[model samples]
Target: MSVPELETLLVADREQVRWITLNRPDRLNAISPAMLDELESVLTASADDPSVRVLVITGAGRAFCAGADLSPGPGDPDALPDVDLARSDAVFELLERQPQPVVAAVNGMACAGGLELLLCCDVVLAAAGVPIGDMHANAGLLPGAGGTYRLPRRVGLNPAMWLLLTGRTAPAEDFLRWGLVHRVVAAGELTAAAEELAKLLSGKSPLGLRRMKELVRDGLAQDRRTGLAHALAVAQAHQKSADYAEGVRAFAARRTPRFTGR
Candidate 1:
């Protein structure tokens, strides 16, 4: 979809890159049930599209995402709508299951559910002033999203514990030091930096990149021997692919390889 068709969110396609923006600038791009549903659908749809080589999520306003919308209404409880977690499972599933890479351009405060979304992305780019926090416990609410699980894996137990327990906010620099974000750039430079990284990642063999993400995610749970065996199988499969041959040929010709992800 082009820029105008985008309503609550904007989906822009530029040379195999799909840029998704949370368009609720007035509310700091808060996560409403409808927003969550749309985000899941869009990401999942992009996952199946071979034309989309990379996916980037960002916010339209100054803040990336301020967490769930606590607007008052009949269905709204404690500000957030009472949508079943299952309804938005697609968001987490798409990120963890998709073959294409996902990046989050966290330009502003990304807290609670917003932070969880960032955690699911393969690469995270936060602006210098943006603060990342997990405030579920502080708010007297458990993380209905993926926060409870993914946080520890990304930032490790001790650091994750400190943040989770204290409900403290961490700046971009702190996250960079702890390896939460891939990079921290200036405010206006966030999107460009993220896109540059996406382009660099997209230039590689699509299948290789996909498999690498899958293995890295899955390997953490597997024993070393089993992980090695799985790695060998994946490596062998890629070695036999037509794109592998094309990669070799391109190297010989000193030209850019056109990977079909076969």
Candidate 2:
């Protein structure tokens, strides 16, 4: 299938996985307001398309994203008028609410707002040696995009505080210990590894994936009892899905299940 034409992004579909590349190599794939708009449009389309089962977001050239584009061209139509919490929150919410799983393939430098963007992904895989950090403190600023909350949830309170306070960039491998990164691969293998993971996830039942993602994300803010209750409710509801039946029959038949994502 032909991929959609986009100026700030290069998108492609393979084996039901949609790969969205941040394509601003000169700026190290910095997030301009135009890029944010393009991302929202692409993600909205992917969410509505039944063929798209998973999403892998990465950057072009040497960096994943160097943060927001503070300097935009005069002709840039999608440039944000200002950097504010509401705008940042909206973008992050768009990312988090997508039904399909979103994976961040952090290929290189991910700092400041870039790191905040990565936090929105369901899974994060980073290239070894790539630097990652919360750099807002360096600029005498704070994380405006779910970073303050998401960072602590991902890496724990103390680690999040250290990163945010120091404004120091650490190698990607360092974050694996903190659970900020799911996997760290050699720089050359980053794309392939991310693709492999995305394909693996895409083959599963779509309903199951979406529900599980929702449960985990929502459960984070709830008490243990409340979270368990939510999980049980989802499990009960999923029993009525066609994919659930196929999964059970396939297990009994010793065969691979064909999930229609129902």
Candidate 3:
């Protein structure tokens, strides 16, 4: 559902997919401080809602996101007293930990914080020829919102360094080859393509997807053996779920399974 007060975001729910569009086309949908708070709020809500099986994060207009707004807005955390330093990065971390699988619909240019946003999501479907980069160096700023850590882990050290160092943009094709973007479609087809993917994900069992997401995200931090152990543990627990039983029954019955997210 759309929140009228959200100045920088346009949120809507179509079926089980929650589309969170960064609005501020005039500003190229830059991540202002207000935008970060709104994003955190929306993401938190989506994570809590059982009906929201998938999330598609995109931007309005020609650009996905141009990165952080250089001009500080009113009530900036840095300008406030007794500010929680950890709060700054918590928004980015929340996206990473969010249970729903996120699909980033990268359109136009996604740079700096935009790239950081992509790294948090599970998969990225970018518009063909869309350029993405970590251009913080050009702006005399370092990526403070989990970009440096997530970027390298996602695209390898050399490729990550190339973007972080050069402050130059590469076509979406480059990112797809680098294992960052999942797929690329034409600019006009981006929204429809993203919606198609979201709907595809929405048809699956929510509980199953959430647990699988947890496995992949958690396993990434552990050794192969430890990760395998964790996966087995998760699988053992999941076997007792109603969704699992329904899945088995539906397979035997040769029908589409109905999952209630249990």
Model 3: per-residue Cα lDDT at residue 219: 93
**Root-mean-square deviation (CA) per prediction:** 2.4, 2.9, 3.1
RMSD in angstroms between candidate 3 and the native structure over all alpha carbons: 3.1
Residue-by-residue lDDT tens digits, candidate 2, 1-262 = 3335689999888879999999999988877777877887887888888899999999999899988776644788677445556776797789988999999999889998899998899899998889999988997887888899889988999989999999999898878999989999998898889988988998899989989889988898899999999999999999999999999999999999999989
Order of models, best TM-score first: 2, 3, 1
Candidates 1 and 2: which is better by TM-score? 2
TM-score of every candidate relative to the true structure: 0.92, 0.93, 0.93
Runs off by more than 4 Å, candidate 2: 1-5, 72-81
| Two-way lDDT contest, 1 vs 3, winner | 3
Clashing pairs in 3: none
1 or 2, greater by lDDT:
2
Question: Which lDDT tens digits does candidate 3 get at residues 76-174?
Answer: 855533322255478888998889889999978899888888889998999999889999899777888888899999989999999999999999999
Off by over 4 Å in 1: 1-6, 74-80
lDDT digits (tens) for residues 168-200 of candidate 1 = 788988888888898889998987898798899
